[model samples]
Target: MSSSFEFTSENQDRFSQILSRYPYKRAAMLPTLHLAHQQNGYISPEVEQYVAGLLEVSLVDVREILTFYTLFFQRPMGRHHIRLCKSISCWIRKADRIEEYLVERLGVASGEITKNGNFSWEAVPDCLGACELAPMMQLDKDYHGPLTPDKVDQILEVVSDSDSKV
Candidate 1:
C-alpha cells in the first residue's frame, strides 16, 4: 500500500491561517481538529497526543473535541465511508439484505474499514430523510438509495477507479 499518507504542505499553511483567526490558540481548536482529520484519514490516539501538545491543551480537551463531533472519526476508516440506513421505513423495504450484501462483498465488519482500505461501511438507523429512496445509504457527502446490491456494487466501481485516492 502507498505511504502517501500525510497532510500536504499547503494544508500546513491553511492551518496557520486558521489558527490566526482566534485570540487564543485554544479558540482555533475546532479547525485544528479538522486539519488533523484531513491529514490522517481517521484520528488516531497518536494524533490526539500530537495535536494536544501542538495546541498546548490537555489530552482530555482534545479527546472531548473528538467525542463531541459526529464527523470526526476516532477509529481507522477506509477511504470511502458508506452509511446505510436501517430506519423503520427503510428496513421494511429490505435494508437488511442490502447490508448483508455490502458486508459479504467487502469482507468487513460493521463500523470498521475494509482491508483494502477501499471502503468503510457504517450501518446506521435512519431518519434517512428520503422515504422516497427508502433503501438508501449516504456515501461520503452524497445520498444514494432505492438500492439493490447491484447498484451498490456499481458505485463501488467509482470508488475503485484508478484516479481515486484516499
Candidate 2:
C-alpha cells in the first residue's frame, strides 16, 4: 500500500540514531513507531506498513504492538488529547465526577472530540503512576491533578483560549 506519510529528513536522522542503539532492527520497533507517531500524529495503516518495512518485520507485528499500547493512538486525535486516569487510586478520588464534568463542559462523550476540534478525551484504565495526584488527567504532555470541577473548568478555559489564538 502507498503511504502518504514519510519522515522528514530530520526525523529520518533520528530514526537512524535510534536504530544504532539496538542490536537488531526489530529491537528498535517501539521507538521507531513513536517517531512515526510523533511525525504523523497517529498510527495509520500506512504507518504500520512503513515501519514494518523499515524494521523488516511483518505488518501483523506492528499492528499487535499498536493494539497493546494505549499510548499509540490508532486514529486521528484533536490537537489536545486528554487521558484521565481511571485506576483504583484515581477512582477512589472521584475521577468519575471529573469525567462527567468534562463530558458536560466539552459537550462530547469520552473518546469523542469536541465539534471545534480542539480536544478529545478518554478515560484510561491504568495508573498514570501519579498516585499522589489521584484524580489526575493528562492534557497533551502535562499532567494536572487532584482535579475538581472548578480546576477542570480553568484548564479548559486556558486550552480553549490558546487554541483560539492558534
Candidate 3:
C-alpha cells in the first residue's frame, strides 16, 4: 500500500472541531490520531508525517505518541481485532487454553493477522475490566467471556458473515 495519506473532508471538519476544543494544537494529538486511524486502518510512517504537519509538531513527536499507546497500530491489521485479556484474573480462569484454541482455530499466532486478513488476535497484559467474565475477550467493540471452543466458533462464524456483508 502507498504511504501517502490525506484526511477526508469529513475528517478534516472533525479535526478542526477537535482542535477548537484544545488550547494548543498539540493537545489535540490523540483525537487527531484517532481520526487518522479511522480513515486508514493503522498509522503508517506517512500518516505520522501527515499528522505532524497538520499539528505543526515534529515527526518524532507523532512517533512517540503512536509508540507509547497500545491503541495505535503501526502496521495494517485485519478487519477484526481480537484482544484477549491475559490479566491475573483471566489467567486464573485459564485464558491460556482460550488463547490456544483461538490460535489453532484461526491458524494465526498472537499479533498476526489471518491469511485472508479477516482477523487478528493479541493477548493483552492489562485487565479488560471484566473480571466477572474472566477469560474474556474484546472482539472489536463487543465483550464476550468464559468462552468455550464452541462459543468461539459461533462468534467467529457470526463475525465472518458480517464481514462478508460489508
User: Best candidate per TM-score, number?
Assistant: 3
Estimate the TM-score of every prediction: 0.80, 0.91, 0.92
Lowest summed lDDT across 10 adjacent residues in model 2 is found at 1-10
Q: Give me the displacement of residue 135 in model 2, in angstroms.
A: 1.2
Q: Which lDDT tens digits does candidate 2 get at residues 43-96? A: 998889899989999999998899898889999988889999999999999999
Compared with the true structure, model 3 gives a TM-score of 0.92
Give the clash count for model 3.
Answer: 0
Residue pairs whose backbone atoms clash in candidate 2 = none
Tens digits of lDDT, candidate 3, 103-132? 999999999999999999999999989999
RMSD of 2: 1.7
lDDT of 1 by residue, 1-166 (tens): 2223344789878878997888888888888888888788778878777677767898899988888876788887887888899998889999999999998989987898887787898888756688788899888778887999999988888768744654
- For each candidate, what is the lDDT? 0.82, 0.92, 0.92
Candidate 1 — what's its lDDT?
0.82
Cα displacement (Å) at residue 144, model 3: 1.6
Winner on lDDT (1 vs 2): 2
Clashing pairs in 3: none
